[model samples]
Target: MRVLLCTFIQIVMWCGYSIVLFLSHHDHNFYETILMLMFGYFNFLVAQRLNINKSVALNMTISLTLIYVTGKMIIG
Candidate 1:
């Protein structure tokens, strides 16, 4: 049940990222870099606390992507 919840959250985050990425397709590396950093650090922190490597990695990836998309929008 916990795994299912985590998976569901990942799926939602993924869908959100896809939509943002698609809409901000023209954004360059600056946005991407910021996003990656944000995700890496955020995920690292969360994972460290929860002791869940996979979720941490997954969340960071999704978080970075969503952040990048959002950054692109702000700067677009």
Candidate 2:
């Protein structure tokens, strides 16, 4: 459940950022590289805060990534 919530937050963080960037110039893929690192950092934070295993953190990050992708699709 905590993992799932982290995923949601991850998606929301990216989506909110993407939308704001999109408003300026529509460079959607521009944020991917940065988000990759961000996700890594976030996963570390998740592991620390949630005291979860690496696998759980990774899976949760993936779920969150999916949310970002789907959100952009739905919104755009």
lDDT of 2 by residue, 1-76 (tens): 7666765666666666676565756445656556556755765576557766777777766766676667767987
- Models 1 onward score TM values of 0.45, 0.53
lDDT of 1 by residue, 1-76 (tens): 4444544454465456557667887999799567646545554454444545775556655665576568667977
**Count of clashes in candidate 1:** 0
As for candidate 1, its clashing pairs are none
lDDT of each: 0.58, 0.65
- Give candidate 2 regions above 4 Å deviation: 4-12, 15-28
User: Which one wins on lDDT?
Assistant: 2
Each candidate's number of clashing pairs is: 0, 0
Give the runs in model 1 whose Cα sits over 4 Å from its true position: 36-76
